[model samples]
Target chain A: MRTRWIFGTILMLTLVMGCAKKKIETYPAGVSSNQQIGAQTKPYVTNHQEEQTLSSVQEQQGQTVEEQNLQEEKLKQAQQEKEDIRKIIAKRIFFDFDSYELKPEARKILQQKAEILKKHPEIKIVIEGHCDERGTEEYNLALGEKRARAAYEFLILLGVDANRMQIVSYGEEDPLDPRHCEAAWAKNRRDEFKIISSK
Target chain B: MKKFLLFSLIIGLFGVDFGWAKPLRVTIYGPAESKIYVFVAEPINLDGKKNSIMVQEVVQCIKVKLKLFPFFKQLSPKDILEQGKINDVARIDYKKFFLSRADIVITIGERYLPDTGKTRIELRTFDVFKQKMILGKAFDLTNQRQVVLMVRKYLGDLLQLIMGNKAFFVNPIVFVHKGIKKSSIYQIFADGFGLKKLADIQGIVLSPSWSFDGEKIVFSVIQHEQHKLGILDLKTGNMQFKKLPGNSCISPVFTPWGDIAVSLDFSGSPDIYLLDKQLKIEKALVKHWGIDISPCFDQSGSKMVFTSSRLGNPHIFLFNLHNNQVERITYEGNYNTSAVISPDGRLIVFSRLTPEGHRIFVHDLKTGQEKQITFGPGNDEEPFVSSDGYFVVFTSNRSGKYKLYYTTINGDGPYLIPTNNISTFSPSWSWVEEKYF
Candidate 1:
């Protein structure tokens, strides 16, 4: 009786701990929200029935491990993907002064970027066009947009879907390097990509 | 406290006398010849040079006012007095002005009234050619700011008497100067006096346009993470950001009927939209596949001039409101933008990109001839017509960085606006008519 009692207590504690952790497995999002609604609707069950519910919870936990591990693995992969997006995108493409014409080297870089974009069709991006410190601000802003459009069109030509691309121009306002040198201006005059969504 | 309140009330009436709307003509002056070559004498302080600093500051501010006058020129009465020994302030030295090659001799004398303990200013504008004083007035000024501003008011009246046209000698000019983190909008008197920072929107503030009534300003503020459209009311000092139905809104202008014309990317492409006062979209003014930006309303309010890339490159276009017809206005340039019609609604002034760099050009609607006003060294863009339509002010990088330069619409200049050495852009001239109310 003592061995079975200790074993049931341990299993019951593991069931509570596992369910708490599974609630925070870092997003498929539906699990936490569903449990939130469940907590609201039933606030608290009668505490006297804790032993019976604990046994039932242990049975349900044992049965869900196989199925939940697959979902948990998927959630893990999605979390890794979020990190990979944070760590691994070469999203900025630089341009020349007063010219929106993509350079040959820029085109080469975009070719590789285009391939990555094609592989992830679920990702949507916003291309922010920026300019160096030159010209009237309005014209530079328009020029920046033209640079973004040039890049967006080139990506579209390379088979990236048009619906996934968005563009905005910040003119000569937002500089990537913020220095007034040739190399800095070269860096400042470019299109930077931000992933809007993955799902 | 009572003196301060009364003095402030005087300045307040002088300011509200204009209501920050349009300036009113202040001093009454005699009629004069079409040209006034003003010879400004040194201001004399009564009570043994007690208010000499007050007199000197007033004279220098007056010199700045003369710089904007198209016909007026400054002469030194010291040179006239040096030629002939005339040290008298009250005595008439009329021949000294003619000898100094002056058409109008302006002499200012200050006396401290001990009874009131206020500085009483006596300004006399003597017509050298007509051989009589055209404008002479006595002002009891309690403060120096009021004295300087009062002198500027008389100078406006003096210009009207000389040039047969009224000008805003003391009117404010609003322009954008790039600051440490972002560009800020600033207002100064037309003579580059009385600098006041209107807004320090810490990003790129571009293409500032006045409300139809010249009470508020609408500009495009581009920050790193976001872009905004800001409308600042000069009366209340309240700046409200207008939320558009899109990602970015640029190049906001006001129609004569108080409607706002702005360009935004509502459909993922920048297109011109007309918005009501509440910032609700009244209509998509120019819906194009590519970008249609920088829409400026003409004087009649029925037509607009904008830049579009539908022809493969950015070029200025004209849109008529009646028939909703769009027409290409510029045929020469591959990149031409910032088109504003002259106040008279006759000519158009815009900037064109060339191998040398960006230069301002004025195109005649009647003659179809374009004259480039700015040349070489730096790029000049964002030219707008002055309210009088006689001249234009624009931002130019002629000195390696950016500054405001005003020139005649005939391409007569790239005259620096005498501001501090900084990046100044998008100068919109608000020329107020002189009213004597």
Candidate 2:
């Protein structure tokens, strides 16, 4: 009876070890960026006010679980595509307070972004709308959509087919700078680009 | 006990809908502004059904209903006794009341009949100065819930007699409660009792508007994970999800005619679209370059007022349905939105952004005069008016979090609507039509 009990414990330990090993093999250890997307500043804003941009998240040792989880999701989606694919469609556009009209500076950035989409005809992208936490969420959601639609329309004007891009509004949910200062709000009010499919 | 049953039986038979055109809906009557003095005597037969759920439920419903009566100064038995006063039929002194004046005294008695299994309720009222019984009625109710309903309608009639207007009380207010990761819709009584959570949703729920009959609710639940344009049936706990063509959709309002209108980003921009009950896009109501949202149909369902940004800033615009003429309603404020037309269509209440913060304002359409309602610190948004246009409910983050608040048309009391947590938003009051189904 004692020999049988010892044999049972060994079998249970083996099963648990096998599951952990399989999980490690499936998931990448950590997503590393060749460029510091953190230090990139908006060409539209001439001033800086926020203490830190949400992009410098790697330096913050004690991060909130929500922020960490979001990082994981963003990184996992990024890791799925090749390194060259990410570099092409990584640029994003920023907006003024409650304004959807693209600034003169933003137009230059979109000129570059539109040119990349023109080259990668097989790639479909999602234009995500983001907002600062200054207004009620529902209204901000509407504001975010107007921002994304502004970019989407501008891209279409730049000769990109409308069907090549899909739009989604995160409203004030996902902030690039999650703080209460004016600078943070300006940083957060932006539109991000994600490569959905590259066939 | 015998008298209670007879009074209720007579009311249930002949006097229930005396002047109203329909049995389901009642017209709004003018309410007297003078404070009413009412002293409630302890309910009799407390020892008989001391611990019964029937007695408790009936008592609670009565308390909640009484607290909402406008200008009601309810004096409990303990309050009267604390002043060393008894509810004597005669020789009752007006000085005993904390306030100098006393108007009427109300007393309730209840009994159970085993033979017919009917509950009997006795509601009595007396004039303080005349020292005589002004109203006495006995109601034989089939169940405890029926007694509560009968009493509510009975009080409505009494209010009409006293105030010269019969208004609808005892209506429920529905709102969206936002939580940590998710939010859901919840319903609460106007008097802050009977909080019932309808559903626990996975995504953020916004703008829960009640249907005409109060049977189902049409709301937008954004869960890209698991969503609903969600026509939710209240009785059966059933739901039908309608995924309309849009990147994001919000701000759903039901017209008096029952066709659903909502704001959707369909044509690469957020525009108002009228949808059928099944959530099919019937037609695009308004097409604009900038965002067009918060569509509120007038009581006649002929006109609409919504927020638009064609001028570079969001402002309220009025749309005449017949002529297809769009006129800007609010030109004073650079930023104005969330305007709901009063059922009477004579006034409008909306939120405006100012240097102080976002404050509520009431706009008289006829006079073209706008008055600020709230002056507190926190931003107040999404103000809605009750059926009679006497009370306004809005979402305020003044209490450290976003909870519901209510004030009179004149901005009387911006009292906090206490909930379990601060998560209520985009409150819409139920509207009543003159013609009832």
Q: Candidate 1 lDDT, tens digit per residue, B108-130? A: 77788888877777777655654
lDDT of each: 0.72, 0.70
Predicted structure 1: lDDT:
0.72
Model 1 lDDT at residue B1: 18
Kindly list the per-residue Cα lDDT of model 2 for residues B16-87, writing each as its tens digit: 333331221222222324566677655655236643455456556666666665466776655654543443
* B67: Cα error in model 1, Å: 3.6
Where is model 2 more than 4 Å wrong at Cα? A1-81, A84-91, A136-138, A173-179, B1-33, B39-70, B73-99, B108-121, B127-169, B179-182, B225-228, B277-280, B432-437
TM-scores of chain A in all candidate models: 0.59, 0.57
- Clash pairs, candidate 2, are B7-B138, B8-B138, B8-B139, B29-B165, B29-B166, B30-B165
Which digits, one per residue and each the tens of the lDDT, describe model 1 over residues A29-59?
4546766666666555544467779988998
Task: Give me the candidate number with maximum TM-score.
Answer: 1
Shares of reference contacts reproduced by the candidates, in order, are: 0.30, 0.35
